[model samples]
Target: MSSRSLPTRQLATVLFTDVVDSTRQLAQSGDQVWARLLDALDAVSRSEVRRRGGELVKSTGDGALMLLPSPTAAIECATALHAAAGQLGVTLRIGAHTGEVERRGLDVAGMAVHVAARLMGSAGSGETVVSATVQALASPAAETYDDRGELSLKGVPVPVHAFAIRQASPPPVASAPLPVGDDRDAVTRLLRERRYEEAAEIAPEVDAATLAEALLAAGGRVEFLDVDITLVRMLQDVLDRLPADDAVTRSRTAAKLAFELRGDPSTAQDRRDLLDLATQLAESAGDAQAASEALLATVNSLWEPTGALDRLSAAERVITLTRRTNDVDHELEARLARLHALVEVWRIHDAGLELATYARLAARLDRPELNVFVASRRGMLAQISGRYDEQARQGEIAYTNAVAAGMPDAERLRMSHLFPIERDCGTGPDLFEAGLEMLRELTGIMPGNFYEADVAWVLLTLGRRDEARTELARALPPLLTSSGYRWLFSAVLAAETTAEVGSAEACQRLYDALLPHQDLLACVGPTFGGGVGERLGLLALRLGRTDEALERLARAVGDFDEIAALPWATRARVHLASALRSAGDIEGADSRLAEAKDTARALGMARMLAQIEAEDGGR
Candidate 1:
């Protein structure tokens, strides 16, 4: 079998370490002392490797071999070991490299091992050297290097480029504990000075009112916009310390905390519970505006509890409360939330009208940020409405406006608003020919592994089945098992790719993950053009769940038809027809196929039309 067919082989970082002049040390020191020293080295090596989430493969008397999850992790572990060696009164040489390694139960093999071994030989005492691949992956992780140029290595087919790590890892910062009593004054002072991280450390020591005030202050800062795990823990501690009697303050704090947890899949249930607590607190205190704000957060949650219909109800409640309290901002926020829900539920025409109202209100408010948001939603509307040119134009407007407004996520946001549209509109680079490295470079600005599924989809579409399957294997597990803001887009895209190239186990896993969300549109914020039910249907068909497949596909067809999403409707009909044919419903199959052909032709979906024509041959 080819090396490519071996499932155990995968990309990984390999590290090799050696104690300098071990032979001389053993000769000078006695055998017993040298043995004791080896024990000490082994103790330190095990601790450091496990601390950095690396595997200590084996000890080689004078040194050891290790495997790490990434080149950055390997570099970290190597540097840490270097520091520890100094404390042990010994010098060491280490080399780390990243490449394909085949696991053989307890040990790893292949070219990466040999390269790493050679790299260790070339390293000077107390130095850490790494291969070019490791340097490339680790450089972006914020480490400086000294270029060692190229060298010929023993048993290597070509010359290898190497680099020596120059920068030492910074000492971990220890946060000072807060005072024993309430430190509201200290918290307020820190927040006002924009030292939010410091303030968060002491947030739990403050009373409910002070915590609420800190929340509002921190909410306005761009630093708090991104996920900070430490900050999240600090805020959760603060909420836990607050008294339940202080309904108003607790309500606001809980609502704010829910926003902080919005995009994370691990906090999905926590976010729902927090919003519920906030809503109940506000209603009990007779604070309509606060209650409205809490419900609005729920409406805007990345993962809905009961899907779009539930959000619609929450949005309506927000609207009712906003009207009672005369809160224009909450009212507008609720309306926009409702608009997105409408689209998600396949009420496209209603969503369009809601968009018009939102645009007018945004202009009246004269908020450039809100206008940029409106432009993005307009792009979604154009996409589902089958106005490809208009979709492209609106996407550009949103992208340009976001950049001009200096949004922190301007480049990342372009991935959501314009990347998929560009692919379909033929106005962007040929993704099929662009290759994975260029794709990574294009999306490098976007932080997270979710884009891996997006790249996999392009590979699958371009007929690179092996590459697509490899990426799908890497990207599917997390998306299938976790819940997050981008869950819909990532899961649907993975499902589509998986149906084409996935193994049986992967297909089953994706089908299970997506089944619960089958009724909602496969969207990221407002971007995906239509129903995820279609992808779910395709997965069901692949898994041989015939009845479920037909049910899902037929439901998707109705949804796209309801929204006038002609392109998606055409695609779903084709798939549905294929499923029907397999189920031996010949008449039903012919009817669906003819309808799909008509719609695909009308919408100028050339690729989809070709797919319909080739349904009997193979899709």
Candidate 2:
């Protein structure tokens, strides 16, 4: 064809597929067998592409690239190819993207093709991944897309949003009749009865408005009352089935779902994204209450210091919007969110003021749950600020209120919160043992990386280095599966534990994984502790990088003190002092050690005080 007559660019869906572990298959099975298998795979892939109106552009030995008219066609073709390859005892990793592509004779070249190839490389064996553009164009089929979030594709200039397409299930048949009584009441009864599957099945039979109301009501009823993962999943499915055009319904449901997923280590990333999406939707819908709630949820999810500025910004917006709308509940929530973010960012004075305002609002509102939440925040603040006795006192009140108010997860939260306080106070080995036991039990009830890492931290503190290492190993798998403040905290704890018991090489691996996020700050326990930089300093010390350790620890100490985290500041000082002493800087070491000792004594930290005294005695 003449260049003038040829099509330079056209919108198309590009699909890339490759055999999983082709090298292994070739090495295990000789060239003869491999060639046969490759032939069979190529035949099946081409057949699927042809059936879906996709043109095979070229083959790359173990796989082929194809072009389809639409994203739906491309996705269907990829899914079919996956199933066909599975039947052939082969696994294929596939990726698809919808964008403008340059048609060069029989072959195609463009950003879309490169993106698809990178996405294919990202997919696991037998998995199909697609770019957000493809997902948006796939229409009803897009509902099957499970968001994998943004991924840094190799060779791509920017991060690409990707989704994994799950195998489609048959549409639910409304064969079952709706339960009797009020629609909301029926759904609530089913949820309370734990008939989640049945509730989900019947939810779509109700009108869209009624289903939205029932789902929101059911969500509120079970939110703090139980750990019902199945119920939450069912509710999400029901909400997904509701009319998408109703932004209010979508925003409310998303906010409610985000709340349900918050603090759940397995769903931390999801919670963050869902809250963000909810905020956007609510704002677009002009629903101030929903937007404020979503903003609060967003603030709760952002545990990293890097996120502190964004968290504060969102909180301030929430306050402004709620005040204008006269939403007292949301206004109080905004104040609490602002207080939390302020603390994370080391703006203690601002946090203290916000905390006082929050306390007054909670009192005036006379909400028991709100009172418990405020008390918990106060206890956390006091612990960080070197007020150990006040922390203990506030903690007791918070736990009491939590129990009295019937918060189902209250005991687990309380135990986790108090363990570090006890450790700092040298309250006894018994508290650590008790904390470990509680964590073990809680893990059985709801397994998570956070609980496992907490267990590892306690074990490390108790000097059971080997046991802590094992617990850290157990925690690593889940931490690798997600990204969020909780995951970062867990990963850091695991790294610290590993450094205590594992080889320098193993410690190096963990440290490298954390390097990218070193600037992120988060609460380690009841205090604003565990900045990425602080943990890096500890890792550096373990790796025998004394000068680097001293520098990083000094920075960490300054950061902690600025945030009014006296306990953490003392800990950082102690680390710095130890590094300084090792480097023969006697005067510098003495100054840091004296500062640490004084702070520890003020905080009533017996264990740290004893350690400092022993070091001084040795000198």
TM-score of each: 0.60, 0.57
> Which candidate ranks first by lDDT, i.e. highest?
1
**Residue 523 lDDT in candidate 2:** 56
Write one digit per residue (lDDT tens) for candidate 1, span 245-279. Answer: 87877786786677666545556678778878989
Go through the candidates in order and give each one's C-alpha lDDT: 0.68, 0.67
For residue 236, give model 2's deviation from the true position in Å.
14
Off by over 4 Å in 1: 1-245, 256-273, 283-289, 300-302, 305-307, 321-328, 368-370, 399-444, 584-591, 616-619
Model 2 per-residue lDDT tens digits across residues 1-619: 0010011233468899998988888899975566556655655665667766667765566787888867778877776777667766778999888654544322456556778888899998878899876786674553566799989876454577889887743222211221224333445435433466777776666676765654554422211222356657755775677676788778767766765554344555676677777888888888886777667666654543345676688779988998898777557756765775665556778878898887886678634455566677788778777787788787888778655543333465476557667767874798788777877765554333256876788799888988988887777655544444345666767766766776687667777767866766655323444577878888888899988988889999998887777888888888788888888999998999999998888878998898788889877
Best candidate per TM-score, number? 1
* Model 2 stretches astray by more than 4 angstroms: 1-281, 293-297, 300-306, 406-418, 524-530, 616-619
